[model samples]
Target chain A: MQFTSEQRLDDGVLEREFTLDGIPGVLWTPGSGSAPAPLILIGLPPLGLRKVYARVAARARYYAAEHGFAAATIELPGSGERPRWEAAEQARADLRRVMAAGEPVTDEIVDALVLPLVERAVPECQAALDALLSLPGIGGPVGYEGGVISIGVRLAAVEPRIAAAGLFAGSFVPAAIVEEARRVTVPLQVLLQWDDEANDRQAALNLFDAFGSAEKTLHANMGGHTGVPRFELEAGARFFARHLR
Target chain B: MQFTSEQRLDDGVLEREFTLDGIPGVLWTPGSGSAPAPLILIGLPPLGLRKVYARVAARARYYAAEHGFAAATIELPGSGERPRWEAAEQARADLRRVMAAGEPVTDEIVDALVLPLVERAVPECQAALDALLSLPGIGGPVGYEGGVISIGVRLAAVEPRIAAAGLFAGSFVPAAIVEEARRVTVPLQVLLQWDDEANDRQAALNLFDAFGSAEKTLHANMGGHTGVPRFELEAGARFFARHLR
Candidate 1:
């Protein structure tokens, strides 16, 4: 999606939607600013930019307004205007079956469902970055945060434009992602819920450990998958403010 | 299982089988040695110590014979003669389903399957440590290796009995295991196969990164899950010798 249209949201941020070759995305920019601003790219939660992740999704715009940063929320491949892939359906079915049977899942199944999306997402994010940074009021060395940490992991490894990343340790991570994380020299902040049933605790730790970053922190608290404390979110805001600001 | 039977194996190692309350296990000791030897506790692979893991199971005995160490191998809670828990059956079914459907599995399923075994195995390992240390040719500050790194991770955290550990980053690791690894200050060596499909790469990195051991080393190689090279095994043996011998 080329930078398509812009609308003023009630919150007063300039919300612009884009369709990168068909994939839909939204970029939030601080109102009344044509001056170049720092860019922050956000990957949405597992449910996409839905009710479950509205607050998280708003983080980009929040940074745009309060921190004088420009932020973008790109849709994952097979999401929004992009045609959905069969893998999502298959993954959903598999989850239903496994949950019903109450079985242990091998990583093989997970890779099949997620690896393609991540593979597709990485390039799309790069394209999104290319589009966003070229727009008015945008600059280089981007910041990234949110659920699709796989994209963040790969971007941090391969994309020099990403200055810093905050990864949500709440999804199925493959070995390739961890290996890629070893190449991530950018500063990182990983948020983990100790009792997150869906997230692999070891995997989260492994990704954090593999980071080549000289400066990194793991914000782990004892809670369910989405039960991150408000204080932690504020602390994360401070982290972004320190680095991205 | 409590220590019940002790027999001499053909290779001049005293073999003993135990059933701790309900769990079953075997211990091997250097033959004709009343001289207290440093202990090496072996954690079994996901595959129970059946014909599939016979060679792997002989590790403790080999360490005992070749290194003059008293070694013990404890069965996981549901292995050997112990009644398989419903959770284990559910986990197995789930793994099969996910493998068949070729879906990426959530760590929730892995946790559901492995967490109970790990929880039960940790205390049993502590008890095994207590019982084995009371026997002749047994000593404290032991070396631990192999799959149930969960037990190794836990024992390394709470049970000061473990002096060193050789962690095989080849199985499903829970979040608690990573948290426990953070508390593991004992000298440690971790083995990883770079392309292990079943193992989550990020989790392995997380667990390795979380280890608090100042003297820790990650012996990672390019191979599949079980394709560990002979030289690597020798290197691991050398690691154990340096720490336990």
Candidate 2:
């Protein structure tokens, strides 16, 4: 990991920008120089880091300033400054066409849109995890927080370092990912927007049901897609505090 | 309300056994002289107070000692040492018969089992609230937690003092009560036992969906009936703290 830029946030969190294997990412650590603090990997949707930077930074800062946990996130393969691939671009176009016509998003379209991203993103996150944990102050017993639900599911399923996951069930999940969720045994806290227009409620519920974790919890709040209440941020912090700490 | 017994728990929570009109109840308050603390009405299942005293006391004490909130509960009309009615007995028999025969618990049976209790219990709980809140140390902006969900839905709908409710969706819900849930606009945190043997999962999900509160949240945990994790008590206290405080 190579440091590119650095700034100290107002809340006393140390925000550092870095790149690992050509993938750009940011990391936040508590200001108090708490050595060996638990790490939380902030998963990003394909929306790119710059677009969601403010919201994502707020969450990372909350974890660092309020809970003394380190948090990091990397750009997805086909997003932001990363070079776009034909398959990913084609999938996005297909998704838009189906939605514009008000036709149902078929499983085929969903699989095409999400599967490849999951295939590539999970390893990048794991690689980022390897790099983040190797830093001077950040420590093990990591957590994964909201981004794309399928990527979170796949990472939590395969990554032993992820002691807990706080997932946002606000995206389209492929059927294969739903089945893969059964392999995840870490403690899980899933956030679901009850009236989310962009997501299928039953599919989210089914994914929650499919989790193999003995200590999984579903926190379904009443809202549209982007309307998760602010209090849930604290609730998610407490969930992580219980497991990651 | 007449005090029958008073005891200070080890953690300095004051537990008082009281009788209001002919109904027996218990109240717990923080040990220190903090007047007018927020109150939580502990809704009890039809099981007699004596039968669930240890568990009930633990919850009440948790609220009083941990959150400095006054907590109270009263025996249902046909429960504990109270007089029993033939209809309630018949409903109990019907419920047992259906369960033993592996038959579905129809809405008819659910109404028979719960509606009368709700009718009688809501008024009794309201009266308890009236008497409990009238006391010097207990205050308003009350929260209702657990017990029969239909009674909770009814009370939350009709009672103005209840600012929030933490409902356990473990009991059979009547169709009318499901409709009544739409009238409850208070912030709600509902608890669902995912694999509960006696509770219908779909019905619980539907009841959660039917609630009209704009800020409602559902916390579904992986457990059988009676297997709610101990940590949720603290979570419920935090929920009450958010609204009641």
Using Cα atoms, each model's DockQ against the true complex is 0.02, 0.91
lDDT of candidate 1 at residue A5, scale 0 to 100: 90
lDDT of 1 by residue, B75-163 (tens): 77777656777888889799789878988666887788778877888887888888778876688668888766777788788888788
What's the true lDDT of residue B137 in model 1? 66
lDDT of 1 by residue, A11-129 (tens): 67888777777777778888866658888788875565544346744676677776778888876766644566788768867866876798866677667767787888888888888
In candidate 2, list every pair of residues with a backbone clash. none
Error of 1 at A162 (Å): 0.5
**For all candidates, what are the clash counts?**
21, 0
Among the numbered candidates, top TM-score falls to 2
**TM-scores for chain B, listed for all candidates:** 0.89, 0.97
Runs with alpha carbons beyond 4 Å of true place in candidate 2 = none
Alpha carbon lDDT of each predicted model: 0.74, 0.92
The CAPRI-style docking tier of model 2 reads: high
Error of 2 at A69 (Å): 0.3
- What candidate 2 keeps of the native contacts, as a fraction, is 0.97
Model 1 chain B: worst 10 consecutive residues (lDDT sum): B48-57
TM-score, model 1 to reference:
0.49
Tell me the lDDT of model 1 at B165: 86
What is the two-chain DockQ of model 1?
A: 0.02
